[model samples]
Target: MPLRLPPLPALRFFEAAGRHQSFKLAAAELNVTPSAISHGIVGLEQALGVELFAREPRGISLTASGADYLSYVSEAFSLIAIGTQRLPNHRADRPIALSCAPTFASRWLLPRLAGFRARWPNVNVSVDTSHRQVGFPVDGFDFAVRMSRAPVAGTAWTRLFGERFVPVCSPAYLANLRDEQGNADLRRATLIHVNAASEDWQAWFDATGTEGIDTAAGLRVDTIQLAFEAAAMGLGVALGRRPLVDRDIDNGTLVQACAATIASTTAYWLVSAENADRRPELFDFKRWLVSEAEHFDTHANPADQALQSTAN
Candidate 1:
């Protein structure tokens, strides 16, 4: 008996399109036209007797079954890649490829990476800050740091730490918001909002029972880093995520706007490949990352906790 398989070219197109979720993007990556991708996908689906993608006005999305199939396909491809790299002629160097959100990389990871480099001088590491959702080994990343409320399936997830959202502003700006009672009042303050966490303001208001402020009206920015920068610039009171703001508050760049903190529902997590036990570098990095997180939690600013309450 022979092993049954679909056309290799058809599977290639499905893999690329599945990874990107866009025929146009997949076509560009493969140096072909969108129509070619579409045709290839159609043929593959017909042969399998199942629709792999849901075509819509905005873009395409993988069907539930298709998504499940993709994981297996991607794993197979990754095995081939890994085997090829192990060939005698292949380069001896294999860097630990890491994928993480931009803000996380800048504010938290970058500051501590020097220590990792110092410890493992011989091990090379590469960081990618793309905002795209990675497809595991298909994306060539050994590990990823993502923020999520619940662990997503199909990958190994390691819980990091949760962030508390608190309103922070320049000391000068905070002084202006002080009421006659000398307590900071947000009733008349300009709220700075990070679009990624647009609901932070509402959630903060709800959780803390803070009244009389409009959560919708504010200076809008795309990223948490930008929102923090705006708050530091005295533009307005922006909700700041912990650890990210710890340095700013310590340096007097920003201060607590009010004493009512709300914990974010999402926690930072490290996702890794299922077969990561084979990679010693990944294990070493994971251990170091977890240790740093624990140390951070143990030594969280006790003084600031009392002063920093309330959020975006």
Candidate 2:
């Protein structure tokens, strides 16, 4: 008996669409047109006799069935990828596949990636950024860097460093917040929030024993990068997560909004499968990563040092 299954292309479309919930993004990732992605998924729905997505004016969302189907489909693809990677003829020089958090990837890792390339000229790194905690070899990633409060229960995991959250904004904006005594007055300031629902502002407030300022009133953005950008434009104060915000603060794109600093509950970690020993490149990459983190300088900017000194 022949097994019933959607076309390979259709399945690929469905998987990508389900993961991103955006036909345009899925199409871009697959190097195809958005219409092609939409049509392929439509053909897939017709084959399966089930609606996989609810199309909305702003965007699309996976249906309950689609969500369930996505799990199995994703797992099947992961297995296939793992098998392909294990093939004897697999190239020795395949790029390192790394899964990392989106914000960290864009703000911290991408900036330092050049340094890594400089050290290991022959080695290549392919980064896939997501907030998802993807599995080890099953997900076809050689390794991953994730943010967490505790170590992963069972994996080759190591702590990188903790982050300090400080409010930051453009220097011109900071000048306005300075009071007669040179201390910041946040009561009249606008807050730039990463997410409306997140406790970023509230946590900072609690840590600093701050009150009287309205944390609920703020410009909300989906990503930390956007938050920093908004703050840089003198729009409002952003809860700047250090390491991620270091470069911006260093370059004078942003300034310390206030002297108060709060340590983050979560820190970045490097996680890999125990069997990663099979890849010598993984070892070298990990060593390079550890060294980079160990020596990361957060206080190099002269202007920034002067500002912090005054604020203190």
Candidate 3:
């Protein structure tokens, strides 16, 4: 017997709208207009001979029937997704898509990626670097590395590491700052500021008990990467995050200008949608990321080494 069913497009539209509980959000997820979503839901309701949503002054709400139908629809989609993921060839050639902050990508992750590639030669990885907050499935990102104090809502989160900030400058710049008494006077130095990380400098100053250095004065750059580069070029002293500037300090491009370190309230987090763990590749990637973060925290303490060197 031939089976009768609602239009696939209308069903898909209804599923999206019901899941999000907002037509506008559904439209964004489906890459269509709100009007189209409304029309599709209307057609779906007509086909089912029931009202799926109730029109209201502020927005729309799901009717009793719609809520019941949504449970079944959502379950069906989850089953389909899980089944597809379990297929033999599903992970064979598909790439893992990741989103990360630009400075973290360039300064921290990029250096370690070759190791990941070497370990998992068959698994291809693609990274997108941006400051915009990722929206998981809606934004088409498999997962993200975010700097935050806590876990993001509606996602599974793993804390990676905390941030430690220290003052850094080129060796030549530090040498030039030394007076006849051998005291490095930071008030006379040009402070390089990261526009987004203003608190870093303030915290460093408070920790070091230094005073009268103008926080507003400096060559302001938009990203930590640029600020580090400017400081390495002998422009001025820049507050450097430990993880990002570890290599630069080791390589002698930058030196610690101050011994005081400030521990940030926030830390790095690995975030992904609830369903991301179902795929074996994503699971493997997550485990690998956690391992790498642990290793970094254990072995990468350039800030401490820098302070010790200065004391000696």
Listed in order, each prediction's TM-score against the native is 0.82, 0.74, 0.70
Where in model 3 is the C-alpha error above 4 Å? 1-92, 301-312
**Candidate 1 versus the native: TM-score?**
0.82
Which lDDT values do the candidates have, in the order given? 0.83, 0.81, 0.82
lDDT of 1 by residue, 221-277 (tens): 888888889999999998878878888988999998876676688888989876556
- Give the TM-score ranking, best first: 1, 2, 3
Question: What is the RMSD, in Å, between candidate 1 and the native fold over all Cα?
Answer: 3.7
Lowest summed lDDT across 10 adjacent residues in model 1 is found at 303-312
Residue 289 in model 2: shift from native, Å? 1.6
Tens-digit lDDT string for candidate 3 (26-45): 88777899999999999989
Clash pairs, candidate 2, are none
Per-prediction tally of clashes: 5, 0, 0
Superposed on all Cα atoms, the candidates' RMSDs to the truth, in angstroms, are 3.7, 4.9, 6.7
Which of candidates 1 and 2 is the stronger one according to TM-score? 1
User: Could you tell me the TM-score of candidate 2?
Assistant: 0.74
Query: Deviation in angstroms for 220 in model 3?
Result: 0.4
2 or 3, greater by lDDT:
3
